[model samples]
Target: MASSPLGRPTRGTTGTNRLRRNDRWIAAADAFRRAADPLVVDLGYGASGVTAFELATRLQRVRADAEVRGLEIDPARVATATAQLEEVRAGATSFPADLRVSFARGGFEVPLPDGRRAAVIRAMNVLRQYDESDVAAAWRAMAARLAPDGLLVEGTCDEIGRVASWIDVDAAGAPQRFTLSLRLADLERPSIVAERLPKALIHRNVPGERVHALLVDLDREWDRAAALSTFGATQRFLAAVSALRDQGWAVQGGRSRWRLGELTLPWAAVSPLP
Candidate 1:
């Protein structure tokens, strides 16, 4: 049997709850919870599989039958993750019993047994090492491994998960929405997420681009809603998002998600400049 094509390995830096925002967003997504097979893939889960385990825990809250599988191009990383799973099974760690998580040695091809497909694939910080031009090919490859009603979430975030952004793609490999999550305690501007945008939109954060205008408008609204901060950052964010929606920016989700420092907008509202 021929081995799968090996893609570039990531820095492999990961920590507990490093992807909490993304996992929470996925758990709340109707598509993820409604899938018959709620299998989630944590692509490039780094040197440790803790994030994958955490993802399983978060999703299981919404869909009790959810399962998480961590994939890494490096076989050694897979071995490490497997060992971590064993420790969890033996009650050596604080892992939950309902947390069904596993590890696999795979690449962008997403080699899985029995032609299994996933309902959601979270590829965080995996594409930061690759050229921006290669993102579409990787997206297509991973999207191909999805179940009919699946999602491909790809993005980057800061080391401690303070700031993050991702693009959601459907099983058909079409980009749907872009989301940004941040720690708003002392957030200076909403455009700070520009640095963490997915590879597809990071470069497009410039004048004349839809994404650029969106971020600019977001910051403007954030400033305008500063009065709401007297109530809370969440309130201010919700108000800002509401303002964006009123301005015709297709902003999705409501106060429930906004409270967690999350804002999602349609891809067309931030598509790259031609």
Candidate 2:
């Protein structure tokens, strides 16, 4: 018998624009830009197909021929999302009638047609339910299906999309970088993204962990840049991230991304210690 789909069913909580930031990051990644086949999979798109639909809409901007396949283990969810395609075809929704998007029943075993590997496999919020020890195995399973330069973006976010963070895994199944993307408006502290850390790091936020220290320093820097808030959150965030860089953190993404409330750090910077 075939192995079961690799994840539990999520409540499928998602909203309009909920994943816009994630989509933006994917579009900017090298994997999406150079994919032999611009095939993006929205793995585990829950009960609501809106996120999958939205993902296709956003990715199409990067590659006009980009095709998105929303995969769900639950056949009911697949059926529901597939039905929504009719609305787009009929021009009932904002999506173009011919948008190259489809839905199917699948889980960690991506189930792409023709043994085609994806250039981007975004499993957002899919691994939150699995044990941390199970994460590496699941990642290996999914990453095995990527084209050479493909990416596996696996992370989580808050219900309303205010705070988000994800890990970028390479086709070799090695965790590469961790990124924190937030709304930044009325933000209390940059470390609030701790709540949305990837499953591997979420429970490892104790004092001795690298992630905890990062958060501690981020909160401190955010406080230090309080004066910059007079200039706006963007200015404050830039100063704060700059401070981290000065202190020797392998911070990635400059003003442009920071201004948008995103900060990326090398995987080693916050990887959980053995």
For model 1, residues 1-274, the per-residue Cα lDDT tens digits are: 1176458888999999889989988897766888988999999999999999999988888878999988998889989999989888988888885478988888788877777899899999999888888988899999999999899999999989989999999888889999999998878888899999888988888889999999999999999999988997878888888999999989888777888888888888888866
Scored against the true structure, residue 181 in model 1 reaches a CA lDDT of: 97
Clashing pairs in 2: none
Error of 1 at 195 (Å): 1.2
TM-score of predicted structure 2: 0.97
Cα error, candidate 2, residue 74 (Å): 0.6
**lDDT values of the candidates?**
0.88, 0.89
Residue pairs clashing, model 1 = none
> Residue 198 in model 2: shift from native, Å?
0.7
Residue 190, model 2: Cα distance from true site in angstroms = 1.0
Candidate 2 lDDT for residue 259: 88
